[model samples]
Target: MNKAFKYSYVSDFLNLPEPYSEGELQKGLLRQMKDFILELGGDFLFIDQE
Candidate 1:
C-alpha cells in the first residue's frame, strides 16, 4: 500500500532474513533474542556465538 511505500527505500539497503525459530527451545530462544536486539533499530550491534 502507498501508506508504507514512502519508506520502501529503507528495505533496499537492508537485506535481512526472516526470523528463524526452529529446533529446540534453547536454539529458538537464541534466535529470538538476536532478532529482538537487531530489531531495536539504529546502531545496535551484537555478536553471535557458534
Candidate 2:
C-alpha cells in the first residue's frame, strides 16, 4: 500500500465512535493493540509481569 492509502485507512479507522469509560477505553486499546504497536515502528512492546 501507498502513503495515501495508509493515511486514509488510519483516518477512516479514527472516525469510529469514542469509548465511554475507562474499561471501554482499555477494551478499545486492546482491540487495536497489534496495529497500534506496528504503527509505532516497533518502539513499543507489551511485557507481562508474572
| Candidate 1 Cα misplacement greater than 4 A, ranges | 1-23
lDDT of 1 at 11: 29
CA RMSD of each candidate after superposition: 9.8, 9.1
Candidate 1 lDDT over residue span 1-50, tens digit each: 58778665332223334542334444655666788889997688768735
Clashes of 2: 0
lDDT tens digits by residue: candidate 2, 1-50: 67767755232343346535656555556657756766887678755321
TM-score of 2: 0.32
Q: List candidate 2 segments past 4 Å from native.
A: 1-19, 35-50
